[model samples]
Target: MSAAVTPRHARHTPGLLRSIYLPRTADALAFAMSTYGIPLLVLATTRSAALTGLAFALEWIPRLAAFGWAGSIVDRRGASVVFHLASLGRALVLAASAVLLRLHPSGTVASVTVMALAAITGVLTEFSYIAVETAGAAAGRRAGRRAHRVQAVLLGIDQTATLAGPTLAAVLLLAGLPPMLAAITVLSLLAALLALRTPPSPIAPARTPKGQTGVGLLTGWRTIRSLPALGWLVTGLTLSNLATGLLQAAGPVIVVKHFGQSTTDVGLVWSAAAGATLLSVTLCRFAIDRLGQWPVGAACAVIASLATLAAAQAPDYLSYLVLVAVLMAAEGGMTVVLRTLRSLVIPPEKFGSTLSATILILLLPFPVAGVLTALTPPDALGHVITACALLQGLGLALAFTRLRTDPALRT
Candidate 1:
């Protein structure tokens, strides 16, 4: 007699294209909007680079802290519920700020408050990510594969938003600030509501030991330390993020100094870079079908490195943008693969917390790098890109060492 099939266990995998994924993706787009807007908005209203930088710095400060605690909560309480609460809070924070910004345009004090609230919302986003990530992992291998593919698509949409938000902020500036802020709030709320429909993720049938809740935090470190593949991947990723941070810190200056550019150029370049990620999305989708994560990810970084070198060498502004766009598109491929790998391997209940811990550990170098470059002369940004490329290349090499040696990594 044939074996009995469980109702939840379909013979073939279900399609991964949909998920309460849109709302989750939309929430990503919301922050893309907020981040893209922050620098520009600050510049337009306040005209102080230092103040804008301060606000940006202020927002990022809480994100690191939030990553640690929120992920743990997601593991213990619930991913979906946590997502909704945090997302709703994100909306309210922005909406309130919009109202205040409109009423008192000159109020730096109020702006700071709202900006900080926005920062809090930003913190909540990390947890929302945990929730979505948990849902993606709930379905097991085939389901997990599809889920991550969906994630690539989601991130593509998110990348598109990065371009769209800045463009929107620039265009909306003509209409004035209040309406724009209100629009951002509405968009965030819409995202939150959409996320509300996502069902709670199915927990693993295997029972974890008591006190495993707190274990999420330490366990991630222990896991990374213990697992050879995961450890190298995490280490490489952490180093790669640091290099990426340098690249990001140096990019605006590269445009401004390497080739004298207008203020408008910053937005234009950002749009170009984000637009490039669309191609990365395409490459990743193709790769997931033809190959696995590590190979494709390593290749992506290699391409980005060469592209960065090209950007460093470009004779003029137009040439630089073209190279930079190509480079970012390549980086996009790496990003997709990384996301897929992380989702496939991480445990469901602790998905958020583990990811949070991993990211917090990974992103530790970005702020320091930013400060380092800020203190450095802006004109020499291109030279720094070369240094960043070397660092990232080394990391990528280390991360992919196993895969390069053995064709099948996880399999």
Candidate 2:
């Protein structure tokens, strides 16, 4: 008798999951490192809060520009190739940054060079993120798993990286920037290799006729326009992101100047928040099932807003840390609910484009946030955060009201 053989799908599923999970986790880790490390390094080197804010904003500018075309390109070429190329591009850019740091050591030239490299890497990383996430969903379908479960696992990996990456970056920065950049380069290369192993996502059929190459770029916008509720949800998320951007740009400044804490402490606070986010993600499905996506998301937005207001008034480091954790947990849960809702509402063929458009809307406010942070006085940062939170609360209320009337949401 022939030896018993494992089913092909069973054997491939584990490998497929690894391929999707490893690269995504690595990419998320690299992103988090850069997100925290770059700002910390800028502040430490320049001692100019304005420059730090500018650098943070610069990272997202290119991402915003690329968002218009990235989805169409990925849809036309397929996500696997885009993902692999983006990974390689990021690795090369990081390696270049490490080399430049080794050469320049410290100066105005060094700062400018590092900032430029960060912006370029940010653009590449954004593209990689979109491709990998789209591919992961496709892989889940291929593996015969439910979409919600797959999304939960992917979100878990992301939260885990967010939990660990910042702390790792802060610790490594204590050693030096070059070492941190080197580690990121290695991780990027590893992501590239793993991308090679990932199963290819089937490309969306071209929506435009032959000879109408750029027309596909509009598909996502049209899709969003067709879905009234999704359009409103995206609009609400844009406001939420504005508040998030302000917090991101100003949080370190608050820790360093107001709390008089070290970079290590900043990392600790963020790590705690990330931990809370992970816990919230784990509980998200239960909440969504019990309360429904719209109600849970609206409740989360309210909680996040309240936490933001409280965080602004926090008198000490510990209080600020606790409020930050609570805020991040609420935001994390809301993110999961929004993602699941998007998956349910958007057609499979339109996912890449529609999601890219939504991400673009979500990120458009970061540069504005950076400008506001740089312009505002340190003493008034709390007032600004509180105002943004209130605006976000208002947007969420309107969005939820609209969602309640949506026929798709009723089911």
Best-fitting candidate, scored by TM-score: 1
RMSD (Å) per prediction: 4.7, 6.3
Segments in model 2 whose C-alpha atoms lie over 4 Å from true places: 1-16, 38-58, 96-116, 139-146, 173-178, 201-218, 252-267, 289-291, 312-317, 374-382, 405-411
Model 2 lDDT-worst window of ten: 1-10
Tens digit of per-residue lDDT, candidate 2, span 9-116: 112233655677888988889888887777877776667899888888788778777775677656555566777899899888888777877788789777887788
- Model 2 TM-score is 0.79
Report how far off residue 109 is in candidate 2 (Å): 8.7
The CA lDDT of each predicted structure is 0.65, 0.75
| Per-model TM values vs. the true structure | 0.84, 0.79
Cα lDDT tens digits for candidate 1, 135-236: 554433455446446657766776877777767766776687776666677777876776555543343222323345455557567655655666677777
